[model samples]
Target chain A: MIETEQLTRCYGSLTAVDSLTLRAEPGQVLGLLGPNGAGKSTAMRMIAGFLAPTSGTARVCGHDVRRNPVAAKKALGYLPEGAPSYGEMTVREFLSFIARVRSVGGDKGYRRFDEVISRLQLEEVLDQPIGMLSKGLRRRVGLAQAILHNPPVLMLDEPTDGLDPNQKHSVRMLIDAMARQRTILISTHLLEEVHALCNRVAIIANGRLLADATPAELERQSRYHGAVSFSAQGSGVSREMLARIPEVASVEVDPLDGRVTVFPREGKPILEEVQTLLRTQNLEVSEIQLERGRLDEVFRHITTSAHPGPAA
Target chain B: MSAVFAIVRRELLSYFVTPVAYVFMVIFLVLAGLLTFYAGDFYDRGLADLQPFFDIHPWLYLVLVPAISMPMWSEERSSGTIELLLSLPVTIAQAMIGKFVAAWLFIGFSLMLTFPIWITVNYLGDPDNGVIFAGYLGSWLMAGCFLAIGACMSAATRSQIVAFILTAAVCFLLLLAGQPQVLDFFQDALPAKMLGALAQLSITRHAAAIARGVLDLRDVTYFVASIVAWLAAGVALVDLKRTR
Candidate 1:
């Protein structure tokens, strides 16, 4: 439903968004992860038809942003980075104006407005001027405006950036609910937001895509994949014995708890063999588990350890 | 069309929601009264016409109209709502025209409020109602020209102060184009025909023609064309700044 090809945006000698190519299909939630100044907002703005790309094309549905901004913008619901809104207007007034502009009016428009207002919990402050609302409520109102028309594509930049944990959870769940119908491309620094909400994750750094894959696929690339960890109290299952087993590349034992974490050679699965040893040898284990791989590790390793990609 | 009206309604409502609209109206009415009754010598002249009333309009609008128009786009930029406005489905031209018409009708409303003055003129003497109507029309249209300049400048800057100052400076220069000094500056450098053409472009030339009850096509064309030109520039500037 959304795509960009070689989308480059440069500011003089500095390239803010460099040759970015991204896609999000219908019913897919793509989490765009990057550090600050990663050109995430810039890329989103270009795709939303708010900012022009220095080169290349950004298409919403099938309309090119630069060539057909009106149609392209009609297909998008964009929440700008700061959630900027008309401060002088009341929440109801602002949403009504958006509904009018988006042509989401009449019977169906009222229903959509009520639904978004209830979903975002903007009832008490609906009549209050938007300038007086707190930041969290303002963010929710911003979300309400974007989704009021129920567009096909939603580009949200740092959607859950400043909210408290509870507010963050509400927003996450809202995105989760909405993710099943529309294409969602959300840029966030929080990895857990991706874990909880995203079906696909794209890791970017220095305005370049480092890795784009599903969560399981990214986890499989983790170094800790297939490693087995167990806290054994008795039954004489020693770290030496685990290391002596076939495919056991290395072992680490915790001095405080006498737990052993084994790493398998050639990325082999050692959990089944270790479980067999525990059954055959009658090892009394307090905790036994296999690492599903940490996304934080993959995120950090790919973002930091890898080269910074092509120069600006 | 509904999209344009949505923007227009919102813009108009915002102007009234704050103290800005009331303050501008009070200052404008007070200044128009002061200039017409005191500076232009309305009673002293003892004429049956509204000549003095229309005489001070050019100078009054030069300062007051910019104050009304300087925030149309500058506020959008400073408040960061320009991004929101552009992200919507409306085109730049539609947005610009919507805002332009809102301010235009606002100035028209203020001009309409001066009807009591026209009535007072008629009660005091036998004033030409047709001429009075033409003067009001000319003043409103010329105010549009000034507003277009201010709106364009506002789009160029995020600071309303800068927009006001720049608009006043440009309007002052355009007003200067009517003065005899402009000819002295350009008389020797350019041919007489070119100098004459420059003088014809002066705002006071067309404005005076209309105020004198001569609604020539050229004067009407000049105001309408200049309004369109400046508004078109405003749309272009909006597109330019949105990309930045």
Candidate 2:
């Protein structure tokens, strides 16, 4: 479990992380969302015990971060931003060093070591220096080190930030596999990642919690929620006819793609009505999707509306 | 602590994994031998002792110890690994002590490789082995002082070159604190008592005193005190100036 109460950090007069309070249970994968410079990394650093908070407190597995950092850290595994490690050391050597530092030695330590290495699929690069590994491989190495000790709480700052699609998928699957057993907190600007991995999402802007809800709930806050958008073979769909539907609030034609979107009134279901309209009109509809909600729109709405924040 | 030991092992392995350890050892060994023979005139003195060898350590370490200690924290900061290392179940003090001890041991290892000199002296004449041991101990202690200072300077910045220059400048000042020319420059500006105390702070003075084949508690305490003070400051600086 991870719990932080009003955790704040200031560099000089500028506040990097403001009064922020959050919690993640064992079964939760809390996705911390924000735009660039939204203090996501800074908040993770505070919870991971790398940066001391200027005020408030954070606790990991019941250990206060400031009062008992070592104990707190013992229960937490943190993958810092950029996935930094000792680049000069081989992957095996680096993991072994982490094992030793974490006091994970002897038979049990070796077992756990092999388990993590194989889980992360790092056997092939075990002898290669971390510096020589590709960016995606290095990220996997970072993930391997974080999960080596199998701590109850894992805080990863942008775990799959720079990985290719396949790597991102594998990492997401790994997180999904681990989600039920540990409280994993990941910060990312990737909305798709938030949907794929996070059960609970917390959106921050200007160092304050703007919204905290399930991915679906945050999506519901998007203007696209309960809206039906379709692309016709040509401009055969009339905007006024769709807008005339009583449940429909507004009809919008995407200027870029010439797709027409029929928005519902107060998030009423409009997919059925839009389908009936399209069939009766004898319009050639190519594709259509009822957005659960557009997280990107919600994200922009929450972050950009707030003051422009500084990046750490 | 196991954490400290782990860090020390990693640091030592890192030193050897690159050419750094070999280069430092070769240079230290070559320089110590050359200075002892040419400057100390071992043949003219007709003494089997390694006194002249011990005398040259302060100057030797002044330029070289920074090489060992400069990367202690600077590299970590620059590469962004300070976050990983600090987030472990280790305190800043543990990390500081671990890195410091690792560098100290590396220097001690190089000093030990000078066993050929010890063996040659023993083979030639009856040198007081006890005094030679004491000299070696004192020289190691002095090197510890230099390493501690360099480690502290390394904590102050992310640039290794900056750390090197800063450590060298401070070590240089400390080395010359007891010199007659330096004292004369300050004699008119400071009180006689203060000047005496300033001389007492010179790392070379305590090192030279121990090189004379004596291990006074005062001299040992000076080295221990210097190490502790510098390391304490390093811990403080790491907390204060770490990259965000």
Candidate 3:
């Protein structure tokens, strides 16, 4: 439902989004993973018809954003970074204004407005101005404004940036509930958010797309996938004893928690070898598990490997 | 068209929801009243017509109109709401005209509230009500001209103070273009034809012609044309600067 062809944006000498060609199909929640100043928001602004690309074009549904901006924008709902809003307007007044501007009026519009207000739980503060609301409440109001029209496509730039953990869970639940038969492209730097919400992840850095894959596929890129980690009650387990196994490439013991981890070689599984060692040595293990993957390690590796120079 | 109407409604609602509308109206009415009666010697002149009242409108609007328009587009840019606004299905032209109409209507309403003076003129002597009506029309039209210019200046920057200063500076130049002293300064350096054209560009010239009890098509056309030109500039500026 969302597509771009060599979409690029430059500010003077700096290229913010460089030759980005990507697409998001219906029923897919694509997570745009990038560090700060990675042009994620710039790319989104071009696709949302808010910023004109320096070259190439983006399309929403079937409408070209550059050629038919109004029609293209009609199909997608966008929450800009920081979720900026008119602070002087009440939540009710703000949503009503957006509905009218989007032409979401009449009986069906009223029903949709009611549903969004209740879904965002903005009933109590409907009459209060947005400036008086806390950050979490204001973000909710921004969400309500975005989804009020019930558009088929959504492009949210960091939707859960400043919300508390509980608020973040509820927002994720809302996005999850609306994920069926709709295309949602969300940009976030938080790695756990990708595992919790997105089905697919696209990693970008310095305005270039580095990796795009499913969450499971991305996790597999980490060295810790299929590795075994356990905490023992005694000093029976040592790095040298665990590293002696052929499948085990290396072993690391956490200095803080005193947990021992056995990493595999060539993405091989080392759980059985670690279990055999525990059985033979009779190690008193309190906690043990086969590590699926570590997203942060994968994210850091993928994002950093693309740029090999000194840190600027 | 509905999108334009929706924007207009929202802009008007925003104005009334804060103290902006009340404060602007109260200050405008007070200043216009004081200038008309005290500065223009309305009572001492003892004329049946509202010549003194119509005479001070251009200078009065020079400062007041900028105050009303300084926050037009600058506030949206500074607050980052421009992204949300343009992301809607509405075209940039629609947004520009909607905001312009809303501010024009507000200034028109303020102009209308000076009705007691109109009534006083009618109550005291046999004044030409048609001429008074023409003066009101001309005053509002001139206000629209200043507002259009201010809107363009507002779109050029994100700082409201910068927008205000730029607007006042531009309006001051336009107001002085037709004055005799300013013309004399340029007379020796330029041709008579160029001087005439410069004089014709003055808002004060066209407004004065309209306030003289004649709804001349030329004077009305001047105001309408300038408003359209400035608003078009504003739309272009908005489209160009919004990306940055």
The fraction of reference interface contacts (C-alpha pairs within 8 A across chains A and B) present in each candidate is: 0.82, 0.77, 0.86
Instruction: Estimate, for each residue in B17-102, the C-alpha lDDT of model 3 and write its tens digit.
Output: 99999999998889888988899898898888888888889898998999889999999999999999999999989999999999
Best by TM-score: 3
Better of 2 and 3 by DockQ: 3
Task: For candidate 3, write residues A221-250 as lDDT tens digits.
Answer: 788898899999764345677889998898
- Winner on TM-score between 1 and 2 is 2
Task: List clashing residue pairs in candidate 3.
Answer: none
**Which candidate wins on DockQ?**
3
Which digits, one per residue and each the tens of the lDDT, describe model 1 over residues B1-244? 8899999999888889888788878888888888899898899999878878887888888999899889989998888888899999999899988899999999999888888788899899998898889889888988999999998998889899999999999888888897888778898999999998888888977877776766788888898998899989988998886556
DockQ of 3: 0.81
Worst 10 residues of 3 chain A by lDDT: A303-312
Candidate 1 docking DockQ: 0.69
lDDT of each: 0.87, 0.90, 0.90
**Candidate 1 structure quality by residue, lDDT tens digits, A59-138:** 99999898898999999999998799999899999999999998998898889899999999999999999999998999
